[model samples]
Target: MIIITKNAKKYFNYLLNKKKIGTQIYLFINNPGTQFAECGISYYNNKQFSNDNIRIKYDNLFIYINKNHIIYFKNSKIDVIKNELELQLILKVPNAKKKIIKKNKILKNKIINVLNNIINPQLKQHNGYVFLIDITTNKDIILEFKGNCNGCSMSNITLKEIIEKKIKKLFPEINNVLDFRYYKKK
Candidate 1:
């Protein structure tokens, strides 16, 4: 899970509220998959949220990460960097290229175990169960809803508050826990 420093959070909230709808902050590698890679931040409002991006919300701030960028960003933190010339928000991905955990098997299995043991049991009472579809290239978990869970009015609530929170707690290495049905390519 990404951490926004308190100072950065305050500043980001101010900037985010001022932007028009659809605005999102992006953290990316200037030169990916290399020793020369450096992480940077920028803001734009264009494409709507889709399967290709991992949407992260910290309070009112919305950050969008391209699915391919997840491994590079897993352990990163966002902070405000201020100097005499300029002040800005930055993504700090230490050991950027050297530590990409691609398609982590152990973490994926842990997620499945949690779902079966804790989550599905609760959902089973409601005649619902969730299935792990796949771990995306970015390492985000993609889940497919089944039984009562599929097309349930409260599915979003379950995905965000319960399912997502549980997965993030168990595997911080994952970027975003996304429902497969939510993707609408644009």
Candidate 2:
């Protein structure tokens, strides 16, 4: 069953209308995972090693799910929640009681502070700044490159070979690093 939030009706209707004849919108609950959606974009969710929340927004419509409730759905259920929230069907599968690791916010903050104080200052000459975007329990770090580094050809190399290497030396727990940068036209 799929649940559609009250605000999602118009958007859902628009999607349905856009579909050709019998073509159906594939809606599935991402148990043991999460989905991220951006404004004016199609909705997507994936179930992977971590059970993340589902998020989406269209016009005034929004949809979200709590991480804790992901385990209960054995199958997919799509319906509207209280005629207000639009939700999708929850997919049922064998419960994989994998250990859920909460993110280490304290460490994340420390890392961010270090980047601001140490990393950014070092890159100041290049009109670049290193920003900490997110940290996951899998010891993965997400960073954003801004200013001159945004469109630089060597940004990826700098992120992996320079920034990430230094960070790993300081925080051994960080096993993976990702660059999440978007260029802003000046």
Q: Which numbered prediction scores highest in TM-score against the true structure?
A: 1
lDDT of 1 by residue, 55-156 (tens): 777887778778777777766888898989976877778656774555466667778899999999999999999988888778778898899899999999
Query: What is the Å distance of residue 6 in model 1 from its true position?
Result: 1.3
lDDT of 2 by residue, 1-186 (tens): 234444446546666577544332323333343333111123432322224554444444444444454443334333333335655432333333333343486788789888988889978889988788778667788888888988789888888888889899999989977876532221
Which is the leading candidate under lDDT? 1
In candidate 1, stretches whose alpha carbon ends up further than 4 angstroms from where it belongs are 99-186
Model 1: weakest 10-residue lDDT segment is: 95-104
Per-candidate Cα lDDT values, in order, are 0.80, 0.59
